[model samples]
Structures are given as C-alpha cells and as structure tokens.
Target: MIRHLSSLIMDNVSNVKSFVLLGFNDTMNFRVPLFIITLLHYCVILFFNISLVLLIVLDESLHEPMYIFLSSFCINALYGSTGFYPKFLSDLLSSFHHISYEGCMLQAFIMYSFSSCDLSILAVMAFDRYLAICRPLHYHSFMTMRRLSQLVCLSWLTPFCIFSINIPITSRVKLCGINIQRVLCPDWLIVKLACPEVKSNLTLIVYIFHGFFIIWIYTHLIKTCMRSSEDRVKFMQTCVPHLTSLIIFLFVMVFQSIYGRFDSTDSSRIFQNLIAIELLTILPVMNPLIYGFKLTKIRNRILTSVYLNRK
Candidate 1:
C-alpha cells in the first residue's frame, strides 16, 4: 500500500508542469495601469542602479572600498530586479498568469540568492564601516585591494552557491499543488506546494546570523563614535546610508514574513500583491538615491560629471 501511494505521489508531481499565480487574478480591471506603472518603476530601477554602477566604474576619484561595495550593492539590485520585472510586466498584460515549472524554480533561485546576497553584502559593508571608523589605522592594511575583491566575490557567490543547493532540493520535492499565491515564486511558497514536509531552516539560520553580526558591529560602532567627534561625523556620512538601507530591507522583509503567516483572505488582494513586490520595488530605487545623495564623494563626483557633460 505504501509503494502504491508513493507511485501515485510521483505521478501527481510529474503532472504539475506549471504553476498558476493567483496574485493577479483580481487585477483584471487594473492590469493596464499596473503594467504602465510597473514598467516605469522597472525603468527607474534600471536607470538608478545602472547609472550608479557606471558612475562608480568610470570615475577614478571614487575608487575606494566603500564605493566599491556600494557598486556591488547596486549591481545586485539590478540582477535581482531583472529576474522579476520582465516576467512580471509580461504577466501584467497577458490574460493567463502562468509560469512553467522550470521558470518558477529559476525565479525562486534568483530571488533567494538575491536576498541572501543583499544581507551578505550589507554585512560586509557594516564590517567595512566598522573597520574604517573603529580601526582607522589598520583599515588600509586590513582592506587591501585583493581582500576587497575576495569579500565582494564571497558576498555575491556564497549566496548563489547556497541557493543552488536549495533550488535543486526544492525541485526534487513531490508537489501536490500547482497554484502559488504570490506574484513571484519564492522558495518558501514552492515548499508550501510540496506534498511532504520540507524545511528551509538553513536560509533562516544564515539570515539570522548575518542580522546579529551586523547588529554587533553597529554596537561597537556606536560606542566608538560616542568618544570621538570625527568618528561620529564619519558614522553619520557613511554608516547612515548603510543603516538606512538595512532598515528598509529589514522592514520589507519583516512585513512580508508577517503577512505571509496570516490568512491571505484577511487582507485585500491588492494589498497582498503590494506587500509581495515591495522588496524588489523599494530597495532598488531607495538604496541608490540614499547613497548617491548621502555620500559626499559620490555626490560631488556626480555633480562634477553632470556639470562637465552639460558644458
């Protein structure tokens, strides 16, 4: 009887070739407007992130550890946004909101890696700030070009590798359902469709560890800044943007998590959809604006370039 049931489960899993995203079901009347709005938003994300990345790469005066990390952050934002927006915009116009099994897995992988990479990069930025402020004399010796390259690579690669393992495990699961309630396929939602129990504890543990590490680093930063006005000024200029990005990220993530746990029927579907896409929409636009205006070096370089181009 167990063997027969297992075969039935396998057969059912084989049958689920695509997932219907019900998040857009209620938006029939507003699809055109949503499409235009989302398109403009996506364009802004691309423009802001890409322009920042280019500005960093082209300008030699901005070649510092902090700016480099900021460039990486912008690039990751672009990477994550690209994974979602094209398909999203396409779906907004199409009558059917279907994603292939492979497409769903790929989207989930991109998003998971993107999120993990964000935390990792932010943690590295916090560490960089800690070193710059707390150990100013040792900062140069500790954060050499080679070391900076390694940190950037690890920040991007580690998350990709971790999620590479995760997506395959998810692929192997016997799925009993073909409907994903969200606008995009997140790993947890995929796990939710599985016939048997599956736990993504590793992601949670990694995120929690990064969170605590950033907090610990900031605690030391606060104490150090309290003693020296110079250090305090540095903190306000550099760490403020990092902290703002972190806060925005954490807020969106926490809201999404809390919203996911509650019954979907409790909230309006439009509100649910908004919550679902906030991470992609908010962070990409906000981070660049925050850093572009907040960092004196970057801000000045941008103005100089704009003034030169206008001439």
Candidate 2:
C-alpha cells in the first residue's frame, strides 16, 4: 500500500499545474468595498514610489550615492508591489481563486526576491553611510558613480538568483493538498501543501543566509556609528531612514509569521489576510516618504519641484 501511494503522490506532484487559493473567502457584502480600498492603496503606493524615483532622476544636484540608493529603493518598491497588486485585484473581482503553477512560482519568486533585495539595498546604503562618515577621506573615490552602479545591480540581482533556486526544489515536492490557506500565494503556504516528508529546506536556507548577511552589515553600522559625535550624527542623518524601513519590514514579517502560524485559524479570513498583507500595504508607500522627508537633499529637491510646479 505504501509503495502504491508513493507512486500516486509522485504522479500528482509532477502533473499538478495549478493551486486553489483559499485566502480570499469573503462574504458578498464585503468584497467590493475591500476591492476598492485595495485599489486605492495600490495607486497610492505607485504614486509615492514613482514620484520619488522621478525626483531623484531629474535633479542633477541630487545624484549623489545616497539619493541614488533611495531611488533604487523606490524602484524596488514598485517592482515588489507590482508583483502582488494586479493579481490580487483580479482575484478580488473573480468568483474563484486559482493560480497556475508557473504563475504561482513567479509570484512567489517576486515576493521573496523583493524582500531579499530590500535588505540588500538597505545594507548597501548602510555601507555607503559608514564610509562617508567613518572614512571620509576615501569616500569619494570609493563611492564613485561606477561603483554605485555595480552595487545597485548587485542589490537587485543577488536576491533574485538566490530565491529563484526555490522553484525547482518546490517543483519536485509531492503535494498532498492543493488548497492554499490564505488569500495569496505566499512562499510558505505553497510549501505547506507539499507532502509531510519534503521539508521546505530551500526556503529556510535562503532566509538563514539573508539573516546572516543582515546581521553582519548592521553590526558594522553600529560599530562605526559609535566612534564619535560627528560619526553618530552622520549615522543619524543618513542611516536612520534605512534603519526605519528595515525595522518596519522586519516587524511586519515577524508579526505575520507569528499570526499566521499560531493565531490566524480562529480569526476571520479578512483579518487574516490583513495580517498577511500588512507589510505589502505599508512598505511601498512609506519607504519613499521616509527617505524623502528625512534626507535634506531629497527633501529640498521635492520642495523645489513642488515650487516650480506651483510657479
């Protein structure tokens, strides 16, 4: 019997090309309201992130390393947000919630890659601030435009390649179930559908690597910031925005992980979905604003841009 079941499971895993997402189980009265609110939220995310990107690109005076990082940061927000919003909106309007195997993998990749890239960019920003304050003499030569371009590319591509490896690992898994418990196709929920023995090790390994990388970067950042009042001030001026975005992102992820694992079953589907998506809703809109308002160059450029439009 066991041998027969193993063959059946293997056959199903290889042939399955779609998943039924159960995360959007809502009553008729609430779906339209939820859809409208989500649409507005997506639009707001795009407006703020894109506006910051444009402001950084157009103003020659603001083309320094810090602003360049912030622009990439905004562009990343757009990239990540796009991965989730359109499909979600479509599901909100649809009577059934289903995603093709390839589509789900692509979404999962975008979601995880976006998260990994966010931290990678933040780490690069932290490094930029460190050299600017702690090693000011060499900052210009070290952070030349060409080097910044390389760092930006690294930030974007490294996480992508790292996370993309999960697809094949997942593809090999024999799923005993096809029902995803959430409104979205999150990486973990998909893994949960796999047979009991397939232990989603690849996702866990990538997360561990990302954790070590973040710890190393932040340790150096704190160490350098402790050296002198000037260094501390520089850290405060430049690193604070990056730190804020990191904290908020981590907090949301932690809360969602905890909530989904331990507390979500008793909760309503809508509330559970909210918990799952809190990071998506907040980070894309907030990061650009946090950097734009806190950094003087970006802030001044924004003010000037507004003034010019008014004139």
Q: What is the lDDT of candidate 2?
A: 0.79
Give the per-residue lDDT digits (tens) of candidate 2, residues 1-311: 32443455446674766777777766446889888998999999999988888887888887899889888988888998999999999998987777887898888888888877887887788778768876789999899889999999988888878777776677777677666766777777776777674555665565566667767777877887787787788788888888888789778877876775675477787787777778778899889889889988888888987999999
Candidate 1 local Cα displacement, residue 224, angstroms = 0.5
lDDT of 1 by residue, 247-301 (tens): 9999888788787766468778778778878889999999999999999998998
Q: Cα lDDT of all candidates, in order?
A: 0.89, 0.79
Q: What TM-score, computed on C-alpha atoms, does each candidate reach?
A: 0.94, 0.89
Candidate 1 lDDT for residue 241: 95
Give every collision pair in model 1.
none
Best TM-score goes to which candidate?
A: 1
- Per-structure clash totals for the candidates: 0, 2
TM-score of 2: 0.89
